[model samples]
Structure formats: C-alpha cells, structure tokens
Target: MRINLRGLNRTKKTLADGTVKIFWYAWKGGPPLSGQPGEPEFIASYNAAVARKVITPAGVLLSILQGFQASSDWDDLADRTRRDYVKLIKVIEKDFGDMPLSALADQRARGEFMEWRDKRAKSSRRQADYGWQVLARILSWAQGRGLIARNPCEKGGRLYRGTRADNVWTDDDEASFLARAPAHLHLPLLIGLWTGQRQGDILALTWMQYDGAHIRLRQSKTGRRVVIKVGAPLKAALDPVRQKEGQILLNSDGAAWTPDGFRSSWRKACAASGVVGVTFNDLRGTAVTRLALSGCEVPEIATITGHSMRDVNAILDAHYLHRDQRLGDSAITKLENRTKSPN
Candidate 1:
C-alpha cells in the first residue's frame, strides 16, 4: 500500500532564459511545466500536486479523485468539507489505488468496502461512517461523469448509528476538566461550552465576529448562520483578555490556532483532566443540556445551537432532560385535587 513515486518527482530544467523550471513528465518525452515555474512557491505546490497524483492503473480510484479534483463541484464545496473529502479520498487511494473501476461493478464490492471501513481507525465508528459517506460522494460524482454505470458505494451502510451515543459532559465533568486544564485553554473551553459551536468554528473565531453583545458566524459544516448572545460566562471569559483585536482565539504562540495545534492542546488538557470518555465535542451537547435544564424550549435551543428542532428535541429527550420526579409529582397532585371531593 505504501508505494513510493519519488522517482516520479519533478526535476529542475534550464529554460530558454537563465531561470530554471521544475516539472514532472505526464508519462511522456519531456518534463513539462504544470504551473507558473516562475513563482517563488512553485516547488512546494508542485510537490503537493505530486503527492495527490496516482499512477497508471486499470482506471484506478486515483483517476476518479483526479476527476473530482478538477471538477467545479469540488470548488463549490466549503473548504472544511473539501478537506474532509480529500482526507478520506487519500485513505481509499492508499488501499485501492491500483484496483480497477470494473472490479467495483460487482455489488459485493460495497460490502467489502464496509468491512474495510469497520476495521479502520479503531475506537471511532463516527470517523469510519464519515469515510463511507465521502466514498459514496466520489462514486456518485464518477457516475455523473459517465466514468461508472452505478455507484458501488450506494450499497454501503454507515458504521455509526445513534447520534446521542457520544458522552455529554456533566457539571462534574466540566469541573474536573477546568480544574486541570491549563490557563491558555480556558478561553476555548468556555467558548465551546457557551456558544455550542464545533471545534472548527471555535478555532476559526475572530474578534470581528464578536460584537460586545453576541458572536455571529456561519457554521462551516451546516452552513447555518448562528448569532449567539454573549452570556455572562462567555463575557467574563473574554473581558480579561486584553489582546482584544484580530483573532479572538490564539495558540500559545499568540498566532491563530491551526486545527491540529488546537487538538493537540485539547488532548493534553483532557488527559490531565482525568475525564475519560469525554470529548470537546461533547461540550456542545452539554450546552444543549444546560439550556434544556434552564427551561429553554426546543425551538429556542435550535435557534441558538443551529441544530434542527428534531435534533434539539432528541438531545433533550435522550441525553439532557432527565425527566424530573417533581413534574410527575405535580401531575398526580393536580389529578387528586381535581377529583369530585368524594361527593
């Protein structure tokens, strides 16, 4: 699976002018330039392109990836979504790059793919489900392009089921995490809990997105615009940080946090916190719990959380709203009081 194409890397060639051009052959006579060889960052970009390419096959999965890469539809996808697709595509390419598309015509191919997915990235069924979803998209796009007759991935089933299966952080879990979490991580923790936003959105937060009153942005995954009121907790957390310009959040270096950098920091915090099975994502659902406990209706929670009313109700019913015994007691009390006084 770990095929090396280092020899296929671009070689530097002297141009008609004194400058040099870096390029790889497309399997032909000359090292043809693929882009602006004059650009300063050409080598870095050229190497990236090389890493994304695959060799000749009986119509390899790489060819479909290549086609998708060149399609306008790829450009239309949100950047975060595109990154996710590319990441999963590379995983599939690593395994099945040499396999022919004709092999996929067999219906059993879909089941085999699911088998492979189930075994991958152990401990996270959600990630495996996501990979299958992306694979289906690529297959669908290929079908649209007439590259294949039917999408083999259409028969594949998801690996993860119930959305509420993830751990929702409790008050005790929050206290445990904050007690051990280093000071630098406090802002992100507060933001995650208070705004009920995803990790991607938390990392991407800018000062411009926050007025003194609320935080507003279009969510990357759902494309929903959410304007969350700056409650007391979030306000107190933000007030003390005097660097109140540009990006609202920053890494230890005071630069904006990259996704990997933030994850690494969060992992360290979680490990030190001693809260097993709890995740940063769980904090968002925890916020939903907090809202429900405060008597916010499902519609009110959806407006703030950017989830559907159905999803909000599901969360409240399954995870957040522990049905109070007092409510049942009150109902029984009302029934008894309304009885005909034994007359």
Candidate 2:
C-alpha cells in the first residue's frame, strides 16, 4: 500500500481492494500540525517533488567537531611544548567567547584575542610570548589541514626584551664560594670549580666514572667523553668525602639532588659565602675561566667542558685574557729566566 500525506486534510492509503484508508489528523483546538485550520486540508509540500537525503545544521556542526578530533596531532612536540599547547586552549577561551573554530578564526577576531592576551594577569609579556609561539605552531598545523587560511600569530613579535643579561662569576668570588662551601659539598664544589660540567652532569657522577684515578664520562648534552685527571685540590677534597654511597655526591637526606634542587641549595650557599651576582651556570663559566688562566689550551678545556672552539673563545675573551698583576709577574719571570745566565 502507498500512502501520500500531500493531499487532502486526512492522508489516505490505497488498499489492494481499491478502497481508501484515511489517516485522520489529531488537532490541538486548531488544525493539523504542518497545516492550516480545516478547509480542504490540502497543505502545499515542496519536498515530495524531490528525493534526496537531508543534512541538518546540527549534523554539519558535528562534522566540524569531528574534524577537530582529526586534527589532534600533538606528537613530536617537546613535553613542555605540549603542555603549552594545552594551555593555549584556555587562553583562547578566556580571550574570545567560546564559538565554533571557524567563527573564531577571523583576522579581527584573532587580533582581539591577542589584545585580550596582552591584558592577561597570569603571565608577563615574555611568558605570554612563549605561550603564543606554541600557539603559532598549532595554527600552522591547522593551516596545513585547511582548518584556517593562515596563522593568526604570524605578526606577533617578541613580547619582552632588555632585562639583566648574563651574570658570570668572577675569580675572587669563586675563591670565596669554594672557601665557604660545606665540607660535605667540598668535592662536588671543587669538581664544579674545576670541570665546567652542568650541575646535573656533576651530580650524575658515579664510582664507575672514576677509572682508578681519573673522572670521565660521555657528557649528556654534548655527547663527548671528557677525561679529567683529578688534580691535588680536587683529590684532597674527595678523599675524606668518598663513601659507600656508590655515588660521588648525595644530599643530607642521603638521596641524590636533582639539578633544580641542587641549584636552589647552591644559591643559598653562594649568598652565605657573601658572593653576589652569580648563578649556578656561572660556576661552569668560572671553571672554564680558571682552566684557561691555568694555561690549559682551548682543546684541553673543551675536552672537559664540552664547549666548542667558538664557545671557548667567548669564555677566554670574557675571562682568560684579562690579566692581573699575578699574570704580569709570571710573564716577567719567564722572560728574565730565558735571558739570564745560570751562575
């Protein structure tokens, strides 16, 4: 039986016996729904003329969200970068009212978002710049996928600049820091003062790194194995401090200190030692400076410090070539010895 509701008020089904089966409408004190008040009950219907599947507005919106799910490609980014990307969503929502991604991607809308970000209280300008850098990468990914025509942060420049720059530790400051470092930290401190390894690299030293008399390891950052002969001063500090702890250095709690924790404790030690304007990184610089001053060649210093020629040159210029009275006297002694007769 074929039923057509496009005709008179009541829809009819034509039966096999040539009889009409009328399906009457239930009115709510008026007329049939999608119809007018009772007349012939004929309602003009346009869809019956064609036969095509309908896509609702809700379905289109759902497909857009599905595309967003398809665009979830956060792999290969660094851990910190991935965290920053997650935070970008919150920044977007706070700056602009939550809307479909398409609607929010307008140039003016993005400009407004950046303006709102400038007014954010949680982050300073530099920090905000870092966040937006991550956002720019995400927008690039979106652009490649045809989600957006271009990156919104393409025009954003560096947010903050011109703060206090590099603060290298000085010679007198190094001597004072070493003299005041606690007995337990003495060897570790000397290693830091002699070898320009980062705190984490210094802390990573184990008994295995000591090959009978020398300390050596393939540095994590540079991937270069540097063998440093334990000199008298370093050995003297190491002798009494060496223990069955298996590792070279451990905190008061008998556990190894993380780089950040070591840096925090070292800062306190520096303050107590009365050394001002120095950073933990400056310790590495101090070690490199002292080595160059002690007549170690650039290659020799780089062997231990994991710095390249260019880096060593900077350290030498900033620290080594600046000669004092001690160096001048030594130079004069060498000259006199070379010209003088042995009587």
Candidate 3:
C-alpha cells in the first residue's frame, strides 16, 4: 500500500492476513531501521519480501550506477569531466554498491549517507559538498528513469562557496623561493611565473610542445588550445636544464611525475622558502598581474593565460592586479610635470 507519511509519499504492504507491513521506500523489503539498509534487519526483510513474491527482483544499486555510466549522457561529457565525476561516484559505490537503489528515496537513508561522507572527509566543506553533488546527479538520473521515487538531495544546502582568490607571488617572493629551492624545482617555477599556465598543463608539456619560438598544447582542464610565445626568461631557464625525457617535468628516474609526487615536491619547496598561504597555482595569477602591470590589454592577457576575457578582467579587478607605490609615483609625476610644462 502507498500512503503519505510526514508530508512524504511512503510505501508499505498489507499482508493477506490484514497485517500492515511498513515496506522500505524501494518496495523490496520491510521498512529500514532509520532507513539504514546496512543493518541486518533491512536485509532479512528484503529477502522475505522477495521470497513471498510481494516485490519485484530489481537489481542492486551498483547495476544502476554501471548502466548510468554506459549511457549516452556519460559519453557526451568531456574526458576530464567524466574522470572527475567517476572518481567521486566510485567512493559512493564503496559504501553502498550492494544496497537497493530504492533506499535512496528514503530521507533517513540519504541523510545518513551525506553525514557519513562529510564526517569521513573531516568536515572539508569543498570535498563533502562536491561529492554530495555528484551523488545528487546520480540519484536524479535514477529518479528520471522511475527507479527511485524521488531525488533526496533536492533540499541539500551549500556547504562551501570558496573562491580561487589567492596571493600572487611578488618579485621578492620569487627570488627568495628560488634561492632556497632544489635544482629540480627551478624549471617548474620559471615555467609557472613566465607562461602563467596551470600546474597540470605545465607538467604535461613535452619537447614536442616547444617549437623554438612558441609552445603549443591543448589545456587539459578547459580543453582550450594555447600557443604561448617563448619569453626570454622562460627560454633561459629551459636552455640549461631541459630534460630529454618525454614530458617536460620528470623525476630523477626520467619518469613522468605523478600528481601526488609533484604536490609533495612543491610542498617541500614551499616549506624551504617559508612561504605561507600561497601555492604553485598562484603563479598563474602572478603572470596575469605581471601582464596587467606591463600595460597588456585584457585580450592579450587571455591569449597568454588561456583564460577568457571575462576571467582575465575579473582576476585583474578582484585579485591580482594592484597599484604599487611606483604606479602612484608615476601618476603624481605625470600630472606635476604636465602642469609645470603646460603647452
């Protein structure tokens, strides 16, 4: 029997003997304890319900998740986007892969899952919120196919609204960092500060990307094609230490650097320089600021950074670009000189 409970549409069963059994939202078993199917009671009720032929033998949650990944919608996503989504979805599977998909419609079950996920992440708002969103998308897909009664995450609130704003490295910061950095870090630092490309893009670069005058590659994050002119500082840094290995950034064994390896090295270097609250990614913003300070227009900055015009302007206005004492002095001198030599 289907009944409305606590303003929610719930499912239950009326036995042949006129006894009412509160079935779980999935209709596969008796109502779950606090909507937790991991408990033995939920499993026993499900088995009994199936044996009596009172509920259909629908497959577990894993089957639905696999089918969703095989759908045309999944294929339409960008490669990077699909990879990121699957990373989060895989974590969800580790916890609830064997459970019935119908349990997802129950408010208590959904709440428990979110609570467990956030707690495991140590209350990291970004990881918890993004992972929850991935879960919400999967459940929404199931609901659309009539598998679940409804999406439980529709009421989930925001946990993190963090921005990318960070401190850009000044010339003094760069000099201090380089003086203390190991030999392996110098090339990456020069690339970051001069080209303003992302860390991932810089690490992925190969000898084929360099054509004597310019570097050519497609950005992995945004998939935008970028061709940056090789500036003097970058060229100078590479001419002395350019590796023969395939990727531009390689470990001592001439192997391509993994993401974790690069991060560890970067952290150690940061500690060596005693810089705080700044990361290698901040170099991209510093490059934008350098361009803006040199009187480069918004579009020109976008060409170098692979960011759109809107993003370049926002970075200049919100984060990186700033007027130093030199700019202030320039403004004052130009006005004063103009007044004294008024033509």
Candidate 4:
C-alpha cells in the first residue's frame, strides 16, 4: 500500500558520515511532520501542521496587526510611507499589542487610544499625530478584513495644529549654509531650492534624470512625473560635475546617499552653518515663494513643482506666499510703476 499527501514536502540530506536521512514537512517553511511514511503519527503531525494556530493569539490586537501586515494593502503602500508607518507600528505593538480585539468594539477604546496619543503629544505633537494616523489605518484595515467588529480609531482627529506658513528658507540661510557646509552639500541645497523637490526625490536623482537644460522625475510618494527647466543657479552647480551615470548628489566619498545618511550629514551641516529655524523641506515652499515673487502665477508654479492647482493655491494663499514680505514689496513696486506710466 502507498500513501500520498497534498502539500507534503520531502528532503533528503547526506550526512558527513555518508548516511542519508529523509525529512518531511507539511509544506515549504511549514512545521516538520514526524514519524515514517504511512504511519499514524506522521499523518497526525501533517494534519496539525496544516491546521497550525495563528502565531499570535487570535483574540489579541497583535494577531490582527500581523494579518494586516501580510495583506496586499500593506504591500501597496509607498516605500517612504511604509518606513514612516513601521516606526508607529512598533510603538503601537509595544503599548497595545496585548489589548483584546473585542475592546475595540466598545466606544471606550477610542478614549484609551486618545489617552495614549495625548501622552505622546507632550513630547512631540507632530509625531503623536502621525502615530495616531498609522494606528487608525491599521485598525481600519483590520475592520475591513472582518478581523475586528469595529475600528476604535475612527473619527480620531489630529493633535498637531502647527503650520509651516512661515517656514520658508531665506536667502541668508542659503548663503550661510553654502559658505559653511562642504562643497558636496551645495548641489543638494541648490536642487532643493531651484526644483522644489522633496529630499527623497533629490537624493534618488540620477544623472539620467537631467539633460543640462531640464530635469525629469516621478515623485516617489505621489507618482506624478514632472519636467522642470533647469534654473540658472542649479544649472551652474550641475554643469561642472555632470555625469552620464550615477546619482547627481553624492557624499564626500563619491557614493550615493541613503536617506538616513543624508539627513545626518545635513543636520551637521545646518548646525555648523548657524542656519537655524529652517529645514531642507522648507526649501520646497521657498521655491514656490520665489516663483510667486518673480510674478509667476499659481498654474506656472504648479507645472514646475508638480503640485496640483489646489496645492499650489493653498501654499500661496494660506502658507508661504502670504507671510513673505518680498511679495508685499513686489506689489508696491508694481503699483508705483503703474501710477508713473502715462495714460
């Protein structure tokens, strides 16, 4: 009599002593099936392996989180977003991993989650809000999968109310940073200011994306492709080191930069230059401000920065442009010129 099992994996290994041993498992990467072929113990082990319980207790939050992580929704998140979410996920697991999944069904769980967020907010409100968002997303995913009766994170409002309206980098900051920072750091600064790109996109920029006159790239987070005419300053910076291959910006060692590595170097440079109260990210809004000050309309700015009309208008109306004194100066100058002109 012969026996056949579905999803049974068998392997034969030759020992150093010239003996051969056979191994059996329920499936690839699954639990081992003990005993010999056609034996009751072997069949029983195989069945148990096939019906292996969830790694984390099914009633716990950790179990649903683990399931969410294995789903296609997690796989579909942008790389940068996933990196940010992973940090929050770790915090959630540490604090609430053992909480009962059923507790989420009760409205009281929302208060508990908000209390946890409140504690985190005391240290950094922005981080607390980000963590709360990630928790909400995870709970929503679990609920959609029928792993939970309800998502307690629903309707959880943001805790951070800070704005970047006046956060644009100034010309003095740029000049000081350039004068103090290393030569290798200069081009990245120029690229961020002139192109209005995120640090991630700028760091990932390769020579192939540039053509002396223009730069072409697809934003990592939004997946929007943009073609920008090279500004005079950025062109001047890029011309001398133009390469047919590899990244446009490199470290002192002439190698590509990882995000963490670039951020660390940038922080050191910023501190050394006395350029305080402004960040590299502020350069994006600064670029928009510069374009507006130069008399470019919202649509023109959108075309260059890959911002939608609404985003460009929002940045101009509610953020950087409104706070910039240069725009006021430009408006007065234009009015003076208009009055001076003969009718």
Listed per model in order, the count of residue pairs whose N, CA or C atoms clash below 3 Å is 0, 0, 0, 0
| Candidate 4: tens digits of C-alpha lDDT, residues 128-238 | 988888889888988887888898888888888889887878888999999999899999999998999888888888888888899988776666888999989889889
Give the TM-scores of the predictions, in the order they appear: 0.74, 0.53, 0.66, 0.79
Name the runs in model 2 displaced over 4 angstroms.
1-166, 243-245, 317-343
lDDT value, residue 52 of candidate 4: 50
RMSD of each: 8.8, 22.2, 14.5, 10.9
Candidate 4 stretches greater than 4 Å from native: 1-55, 334-343
In model 4, what lDDT does residue 147 have?
A: 81
Please report how far candidate 4 places residue 48 from its true position, in Å.
22
Candidate 1 regions with alpha-carbon error over 4 angstroms: 1-59, 76-84, 118-128, 160-166, 242-244, 318-343
Best by TM-score: 4
Best model per lDDT? 4
> Of models 1 and 2, which has the larger TM-score?
1
Tens-digit lDDT string for candidate 3 (12-34): 44322223444233332222222
lDDT of each: 0.72, 0.59, 0.71, 0.82
- Local error of candidate 1 at residue 108 (angstroms): 4.0
